[model samples]
Target: MEPKNNLRSLDRQINVFLPAISLICILCIFISCNKQDRTTVIYGKVTDQNHQAVDSILVVAGGLWDFNIEVVKQIYTDENGNYELVIDVPKKYIKLNV
Candidate 1:
């Protein structure tokens, strides 16, 4: 009789935790699905008109919105004349300058 009673108690304990565990798993799934990574990576090697790699060049991206210069991003070229810009794109068009 004692063994049977203990088994029942253990089963009830497991049942109490099962719903909470399942809820936690469902919440995790929703959180991971709702997150979005909204960014763009622009990369290239800068070169002069003579076709030589131009190092230390300054790259700038600008935008106009509502008659104002809304945002500007700047990055410098690497030693190998490589430049990369990770930017958040809010609109369809971007103007880049070197």
Candidate 2:
């Protein structure tokens, strides 16, 4: 019958479209759940007790979150004892080690 054929066509279309729409919705949820990362810039000069530039020194920058320290950047001082570090972390308590 014509009505039975119409029902079969509708069912076929639903079976094909439902899964595609569900996949798109699931992807949107996952994309919205992602968080963007933030960054901080640190610039300083390293010097010894005698006020002399300390070059080639290792400098580490870390962020303290939830009682955990996560290292974000590690760099060495330049010949002029100047160091620049870009850290990707949240704005919070941070620790520096030289």
Candidate 3:
């Protein structure tokens, strides 16, 4: 009788622990897969052919990735005509619309 009772207790413990362990493993995998991608900074100055800093110019980063024209990020040139944008995109072919 004692042996039978011990077997049942062990089975119950395993049932509870197994489900918890499986849940933790699944959560870890989900978190790792959805991690944020690395970003690249695009900083430059906007100017006309006359070679002057064009202040207040709107800088746009747009392109079609996976068949869709999208604007990843935008920034306005400062007094020095300098703009910076940190965006996460593939390094294939992105359009720089200034």
Runs off by more than 4 Å, candidate 3: 32-41, 47-52, 63-65, 86-98
Q: What is the per-residue lDDT of model 3 for residues 29-98, given as tens digits with 9 covering 90 to 100?
A: 9999867575768899888899898899988888666666778788899988899998777655344433
Candidate 1: which stretches are off by over 4 Å?
Answer: 1-37, 90-98
TM-scores of the candidates are 0.49, 0.52, 0.51
Lowest-scoring 10 consecutive residues by lDDT in candidate 1?
A: 89-98
Evaluate model 3: give its lDDT.
0.81
Model 2, 1-98: lDDT tens digits are 99999999999999999999999999998878755466668899999999999999999887676688877778999998999987666656554433
Model 1 clash pairs are none
Candidate 2: global Cα-lDDT?
A: 0.82
Report lDDT per candidate. Answer: 0.77, 0.82, 0.81
Q: Summing lDDT over every window of 10 consecutive residues in candidate 2, give the lowest-scoring window.
A: 89-98
TM-score for candidate 2, residues paired by index = 0.52
